[model samples]
Target: MLFIKTFTRSICTGKYSFAAEKSLLAALRKKTGYTFANCKKALEMHDNDLNRAELWLKSQAQALGWSKATKLEGRHTAQGLIGVAVNQYSGVMVEVNCETDFVARNKEFQSMVEDATKCCLRYIESQQKPQENVAKFSLDTEQLKGLHSENDGKSLADKLALMIGTVGENATLKQGLGLKTCEGIHLVGYAHPAGHVENGLQLGKLGGLLAYRSLGEGNDHIEIAKGICQHIVGMRPTKIGNNDDKPAPNKDEETCLIHQEYLLDDSVTVKELLEQNQLEIVDFKRLECGEIVSSIGKQPLEFVETCQ
Candidate 1:
């Protein structure tokens, strides 16, 4: 009788343990989006506590995702979007790159770029110095990675890693430029035809940022600022003024803002139009997708084939 009782208890205990583990595995898989094997391993590693297991799995996944992302780092990211965000006091531009145009057109990719740009703009707005003239802010890739998204509060690098894992492509926040207005200045941004309009601002493959200090009254300068932005989009000028000493003769007409013929009326130069409106160009920035070459040299054909 004693032996039978002990055997029954042993059987029941084993069944209970198995049932609990099965339940934990299912729950972990659902929460972490991990495979069955991965969930089981995580559960075992963390003593079957659901919260701990989830955290462990997440950390492991991030580590693995980052590893994959590193491998993709050297891949050429020629297709992407330029995003611009503007508010009453500040503006920001960002370039986010991916491996293909198909991904570039994806709404998720577009939303990420838009959010990143807006976040950058908000950061600049928060750091505004009212007493300064033309406060400028810039973020390199690593700094951009640390910025938290306003939408979900996720660090940009974490969001980027998830995107890389989901899309199976190399994506990078290539550049960021921020501008804040001082006293009489205002900021304007433009996106080319390939751009999309949101909140009355344009975002696309090519972007322009212009800072103008108004000298006239009652929103007239606003129109002038926008007109200059349009001209920038059309002309794709490289510099604000003819500051280049030995300017390339052939490229100067198209590359210098003051020298390019006005888009609205080709009869007048941009310099003359600004003078007519009594507005002065404080500063400007232009960013085109994939304009910067990758520092990583192209992989040899043999290496590419081996990976394939």
Candidate 2:
């Protein structure tokens, strides 16, 4: 009778005498990247079972992520990272935004951006055909969010929610782009303030893709291609300048890429450099994390539009 009374009291008071509280909490936290407090709650809710605690935490995390995202979408998200993935035939860029630069610099946040960019690139590679235009295709956020990963079969939105839960911030996949080149064109990309490279993805504040058609034997100038991409990222030109438009003295008004001075030398114009190398610009794209569209009035020859 005394033992039964003690058990009833312990259960009623929510004070189960679990011997592995610390170990269980630590294991669940490691597995799910959840807070210790939440892990403890899950452990308690599930009778001190680590696997059950992890499952509960993940399920709650998904729900919590959406709630946090919806609540925080109204908050300004001006800081984030730009990630790029590219190959010889195609390239892709994706921007993921967060409310704070502190979150933007987080390694996990950067990894999520990288994964999204890579997924977009894979989509481009799979969807692109020989007849496709030589310009850029704007990837819709919803479609991108719906793309299922081959590894785990989870949609991007699902993974993004997980990230949101982990980061505890209002994160958004603001923009995505996939660029394709024509038969004669070559594609190259560069990330400003060259960041740490991982698995061929570039993560940084600004990124640019430059497409050029070799006019002669100059299509494969390694240094020249990289230099041009770097220049595009730094200079922020909107259009390809006319051939007659020569470089003027500090012509800040000249936003055309060809007329802009070479970023590597600055002694000669980009036009001059291209001519010397027998290269002609096919198209180019630059991406920043949270640029205001209304601010860029001087538009490129063709702006990337939403995919139809």
Candidate 3:
């Protein structure tokens, strides 16, 4: 009778223990997106404390991410997404690259891009130059990664590395644009092929940020600015050339913004629409994911020339 009671208690305890471990494994996997094996390792390391296990897993992921980043550095990252954020007075644009379109569409990957853009937006807010009504600057890759993420206190580099580990891919911050505008300047941005919005930030294949001032009392300048941005994203103009620039014979007149036909109204050019609205573009930036950059050799500070 004594032996039977002891055996029954042991069996019940074993079943309870197994149940607890199964629950912990499932919970940890859901929380951290780590594999079952990793979660089990974390649970064992931390005695099944969920929060502590999560922390340990994330800390361990940093090393994994760094290793993957180094291993995949030379791989051609031909696909990625563009993240652009615009608040009332300032905005930011960023391009984050990965090896495959499959990885580019990953939620974790998109989250990293969102965090990066938000970090840059905060940096732009801090570096506001009230003297310049409109300013455009490129972001240094190292500096951006060193900055703390706005969502969490983790350094952007660590966050990025953790993501690299999680997704098992080489992700890179190819380029970033920090934009600030004065109160009166209408700063707007548009994204083509935009995905779902998260905390006001959107990811897309192509993005455009535009800052312009209304020379006259234009009531609909906001809409006009957005329309121009849409046009900029669609047209891919190289310069804000004057109306006097000649069209290049047969190839659609697209070398300059002022020369391109207004997307909103095909009857008139962008210059004509601007003239009608009494608007002058202060500065603008168009970012397409993975576009070739001939002038990319220059440092961020070297590309700091401000436009009015």
Candidate 4:
């Protein structure tokens, strides 16, 4: 497992408190059945295994009633090293990862993953409404720092070292996805058994999440939500309108949730069917690769300089 000495040093220097470290060590040893002394020694020997060790620690914590198990795996082989996982607590799900598979499965590594996720879920819940009504949301700095507060005991790469040492592999948590619920409106979600799988242009990149206020029966909600989920995952739509003039790239396409043609049925837009059925759409969220895009509208620094 390849670990970044500098990154690990910084995390341990500020975040790893004695209490947290002790808890993590206990959980790691318990889960992997490795002696605490041996686990600590392994971490001391490697720098890249910090995040991996953290995840193993998280897994152990879950076993001890500290958290719940979610999907954890090693990824990004072409790059350096990375791992990813989903953890559930209360009603929240947090995606976590490390750089290597070896560390990801270790007890100490899993503990860190669980702890970090808990901190993130708690922070998000306290600050933001569960409803996705807000247009913008981000993590707070204080809470971010709090998650790393237990980092003081090990070398810069102690966590990563522990991960690598335990798993004998390199890794780190790269990114995550989260959702919450609130009154009035309900949120519906589903994911591929594993994380995401890369495919050509359509089915492979889509995941579904739908949120709307329902005045109908419980079974109705499930049926409707299932239909919508299928539509989203199965159909790939650039825009949801009949008019080519109103392509998804246009501004107007965003305003009418119903009018957007159903990805599953090009014959009618979501708007058209809702009106026909006398249904109302409070809001909806659809995530697709090459669809809901991130507009980082900027040229490279070199390009700007040359043009100037």
Best by lDDT: 3
Top of the candidates by TM-score: 3
Q: How far is candidate 4 from the true structure (C-alpha RMSD, Å)?
A: 16.5
lDDT of 4 by residue, 20-133 (tens): 666666765775666677567544544325457755545453343311111222334222211121112112222334444454445665555444444444544554453333
lDDT of 2 by residue, 1-308 (tens): 99999989988666444445776777888887778788889998999887888878878878887777766667777888988878878888788888899998888798788778888888777754445337566765666787777777777898888788778887877777778765666788887666756767888889888777777773367669879999999988988777576665667766888888787997998888988998877778898768864422233223342121
Error of 2 at 30 (Å): 2.9
- In model 4, which runs have C-alpha deviations exceeding 4 angstroms? 1-32, 35-119, 128-132, 139-165, 176-182, 194-207, 215-219, 233-269, 272-308
List TM-scores for all candidates, in order: 0.70, 0.79, 0.87, 0.43
Candidate 3 Cα misplacement greater than 4 A, ranges: 1-17, 216-219, 243-251, 302-308
Q: Which digits, one per residue and each the tens of the lDDT, describe model 1 over residues 58-111?
A: 777777768878889889888999888777778887889999999998876877
Weakest 10 consecutive residues of candidate 3 by summed lDDT: 296-305
Per-residue error for 75 in candidate 2, Å, reads 1.1
Write the candidate numbers in order of decreasing lDDT.
Answer: 3, 2, 1, 4
Worst 10-residue lDDT window for candidate 4 reads: 299-308
> Candidate 3 residues 102-150, lDDT tens each?
9998989998888888888888877755565776677756767777975
TM-score of 2: 0.79
Report model 1's TM-score to 2 decimal places. 0.70
- RMSDs, each prediction? 9.7, 6.1, 2.7, 16.5
In terms of lDDT, which candidate is stronger, 3 or 4?
Answer: 3
